[model samples]
Target chain A: MDQALDLSGNKMTDLGNGHAVIEYGSPWGRPIARWVPSWGEEKREVIERMRKHLVQRFGEDRGLRMAENSRNMIIFPNLVINDIMAITIRTFQPEAADRMTVNAWALGSRDEDPDLRKLRLFNFLEFLGPGGFATPDDQEALENCQRGYRNAREAAWNDISKGMPRVGPPKNDDEEQMRCFWREWRRRMSAAA
Target chain B: MNADAHLARAATASGQCTRAQVEEFLYEEAALLDEWRVEDWFAMFAEGATYEVPPTGDGDELDPAKSLFYIADDYVRLRERVARLLKKDAHSEYPRSRLRHIVSNVRITGFAAGIADVTCNFITYRTKRGVVDTYYGQHFYRIDCSVSPWKIKSKRSVLDMDQLYAGKLTIII
Candidate 1:
């Protein structure tokens, strides 16, 4: 995913003090103080079409739900959050790392709930690419939160898997996969040792 | 037989805490949770007992201090959490999602002195806003069998997923 914006056509002019605005050709286009980049006409059209389809399939409420969900990982949810995540990490803000994190968080109770949206920010941090947070403590907190989940969707039976291969030899896909898994497990273990 | 085997057998025989008792206790506890009786569920643990779901980042083990866990709660904290959830404004669970905790594969892996090591498999189905989510996991219990009916000295749940099923982990697994 090309996470960084194409700043080839954009210009950053210093507005005195520590603040500066990123201008995308037009003088009157950007939001007041906040940097919200406008989506190109093509992307906007595509978003509208997807939005309509989702609304029709899942109804109005749910259509909106799906759009709000994964906003961090997917298209820029409007301009503010996109600017925070995509822009701050590249340009460097006063708060730096946590700045974008906090700004992305300050977004809204829009997508999911406020809390779930905040949590999802950390979940989708992978898409943000690598960089340190504002403080070491902040980084540690994010890692701790990420590691807290069991992260299980479907669980494999260790006991049953070990015991219940087919009566015959490896004749089926399941058996083949299991054999492959065991072989790979052994290879990794031996290599590690 | 080794002394450890003898001791294990002796403990099980003396305590008379059969697999059936442990199974029953687990079921009753599940019922309270299904009913959203969080406080009653909290009472199932012994005083000063810990209810833990260890952070199995890539492996299954109980490392309290080093790894971050979904939940590693002492009795006091458990009480506080349950209390908070019971309030009307606990938005995460205010409406309370419907749930069915299907527990199976019960086995008493070991018994020694007052503590019995029992394990079980579970796949709980939760439905909220018409979306059904399945959570599969294993629960390991350290029961204090010294008493007539054993108390859950500690419980550690190992969920199968690397990340939570949904973004939110609102209920007890």
Candidate 2:
């Protein structure tokens, strides 16, 4: 707890350059399943679907080869301020033999693009601020931002669409939302670039 | 006049709790959540305490009005949520996701004997299907130590991942 406090303080003190460093330690670390025995017909179906879709969006080897480095970076593009200094992940061969722990350290100058930072901060204050206390008003603003974010996310995915492997298309609203978000995000980034 | 009287009384009442005690209460709650003791976790709340998880977009701190999930003003609603988790029928809890909650930034924004307002920053990691997902949220808890050794009067978990990939919030955030 004290360590977390100290880290937070450091983040606040350093402001833009600071990284919100967090460490979760537990002797109880263990896999939810001792073995993903489900990697059979049913599991294979899901995996194939995931692989095809990922390939279509990201490209080639699907996720078998490049998943480790790209998973976090792809999911959260903003987190990478500078080139990722390092990412270490511990995994077991059988998939569920033991718990896997992933640790990443990023180093970058605090020059968070001003427009990006402004957008981020504005989004934050809008939701967490006292103005959001009004339930209806809060809900409306929240929905609008979500709509924008979904568009941005699909745009992002579309940026890497060329290299993306082909998997099954999104089956539900959540996956569709992500796809749309990345697609729009890519469009905006290209326009700016 | 009624609201004014309530506010005055609340302000006066909140002044009594020591900062350390408030911190301790929060830590205990975190411990319970980390342990995955759902029933015990529910007991931490006051009788009418509400547990809310508001969805914010882009994980941005500025805009909150467009939250995806909003549980407004109901303790029983939270109870129903917990009940669903406890049942075997809840697919979201099926494999029973494992969670590690890291809570920080505990600050006492206000306090009173039977009422207190507090804020905490938390990051939770949930693992399932050989995949790990992360979530960040600020917990807004209203407590009443005077009522019964610090029961939560209300709790709002405002998650940055409002467009959650999962089907439902089976585990307490």
Candidate 3:
């Protein structure tokens, strides 16, 4: 778990007004090679082609930046934009204290190269979305947590203290991002009260 | 002429595969999935085959390249998916759900050269942990029948539902 979090290289930044951004790219802009072991020659070829296309379409520096880095940003309460291997815009609506519904959409650039677009779509389906390999597990984890919350009255508080003593930026696995959100949430609730 | 007769005529005109043959192939494929013989099912794909499921409510014409899809898998990724599912560690399917695949309304819409364009309706029920999920959809397929046993060149399953019933489609459709 620590290795995975470290590999994600998430650095959190509190963008006042209840918004926050977590920039996630491997340290030094290196590709997360571990994630691509299953990719064959054809898939690697597509990545190379897309890299060239990006470089040609948008100058060298910006194109490399676009191809390399990914970001996960939250807009206040519920909206999140995960611009990772593929871009996904997600929002959740809380229907009750225990139930909520989430809506997610994949975002892609218009007029993208056909092959690259296919790759982007493939990336989106591989990790994000309801049926993806990753999201189902995430949903399961969340549901498990909710089930455990049934005993919250006895268990009381949930811990959100990771990397709290760090002097510098927070790591991906750190709970600082959640703290940021909760801080804003508390401020708003106190104001309303 | 009725639709079946028209389709039969079209199949004969193309002289590639008959409706009965396509139906038999689809039935066999469905049986493999229902029995959880995923590796065998995976073997039925052509070398460069693609399997796709566009998001619910999206029409069949939406190109997976240009739009989002619930599942879009090329040959390599599809292979990986099969391998993952068969593993004992695939938490979502570790015990493997009981599945029943009902395929109907099979038709050979078009055939040319060695490829047959087939369409069918499917309703798959997945039962796990005492919960049942129903997935109904139309399947559009491009089957390459040049070889003795046909291989799937492309299979696109377009779901007819408005939303996922259980908020998650963990099982393969």
Candidate 4:
């Protein structure tokens, strides 16, 4: 399920000053229901209801566009706003050389229908939060990378060269976003020194 | 006494499930989890059951629809959760952490219309990769006693800690 949203096809635009946005365009311009065709009838029904609600509330064109597009925006240092199946605003703070605290919140539209709101919250829980299916794996991957860095004395350099030779915009899976963040981080550290 | 004896005694007396029956059920559920019998544990829930865990410090009455929860799985999502965790690719649990679930302070707070509202305090210890983390919480349950083997209609585990120790609730609490 996680791999279906192929980040390799996403388009990343550098927003300058160590910020960037990745636009993950939906396949066939369909809503989430179409993304996972194997979902059971119950799930498909809920998604359809929510999609119809969106169309009714915002009219056809805007609603369809809203359902089809997802964006991840990084704010220079330690904040990310992911407007995906649900809106997630996340930030992290480093406490020590090897420790950091992360916080996340789900954002929803005001006065949303009770049923639709439940669906939104469920979507958020499925992917964004610490207990979610996706984020915990992300945490594990990050922590494993941190552990590997214990050998930094011998492996001093980390690679972020993905898509460095791309002709135009960078893909989401590329290291361009990290490159942006590191560039700004180096600038700040150099200035402080 | 065996499970059937307890249930028979409880049923003959008041036609209602007693605290003993509830405790037995909870203990069995905990055992299934500790033994990593997730599929068996999932079977204890009703078809449309809900499993929720509100953020630490949030009130028990906080509506998951309006507020954020560590987990607020509906029937479909709950099934998906079980399926995901049982897979070899669920990296956080791929090597499956060692877990011990301790359930205490069982109480039958309310009962009506074949439904019983139950509560209990819990402390689950998870050891993984040589690190141990403790998750202590109070669980609020709504069990449907109308069935032979009471099914869980809703289970809400509310943490008492001020914050998650490592900001990760990667284990089922």
Query: What TM-score does model 2 achieve against the real structure?
Result: 0.41
* Residue range B6-58, candidate 1, lDDT tens digits: 65774465366666777898899889888988888887788988776654354
- Give the fraction of true interface contacts kept by model 2: 0.00
* Superposed Cα deviation of residue B50, candidate 2 (Å): 0.9
Considering summed lDDT, which 10 consecutive residues are worst modelled in model 1 chain A?
A27-36
Error of 4 at B104 (Å): 0.9
For model 2, how does the per-residue alpha-carbon lDDT over A44-143 read when each residue is reduced to its tens digit? Answer: 3443554555556765432322221212112222332211111222221222323222222222126544433332232222222222122223333443
Chain B alone vs. reference chain B, TM-score for every model? 0.86, 0.77, 0.94, 0.90
Each model's total of backbone clashes? 7, 64, 0, 0
Q: What is candidate 4's lDDT per residue for B68-140, written digit by digit as tens?
A: 7998888888888888888988999988999999999887777788998888999999999888999998999
Candidate 2 residue lDDT tens string, B116-145: 777789998878656677878788877776
Clashes of 1: 7
Model 3 DockQ reads 0.60
* DockQ per candidate, 2 decimals: 0.01, 0.02, 0.60, 0.63
Model 4 misplaced stretches (Cα beyond 4 Å): A1-9, A27-66, B1-15
Give the least accurate 10-residue stretch of model 4 chain A, judged by summed lDDT. Answer: A27-36
User: TM-score of each candidate?
Assistant: 0.46, 0.41, 0.81, 0.84
- Candidate 3: deviation at residue A161, Å? 3.1
Ranking by lDDT: 4, 3, 1, 2
Single-chain TM-score of chain A, each candidate: 0.24, 0.19, 0.78, 0.78
Residues forming the 10-long window of minimal summed lDDT in candidate 2 chain B: B59-68
Model 4: per-residue lDDT, tens digit, A14-121?
A: 899999887766543133323345334556776777677777888665555466667788998999998876788989899887898988887876776676676677
Candidate 4 CAPRI level:
medium
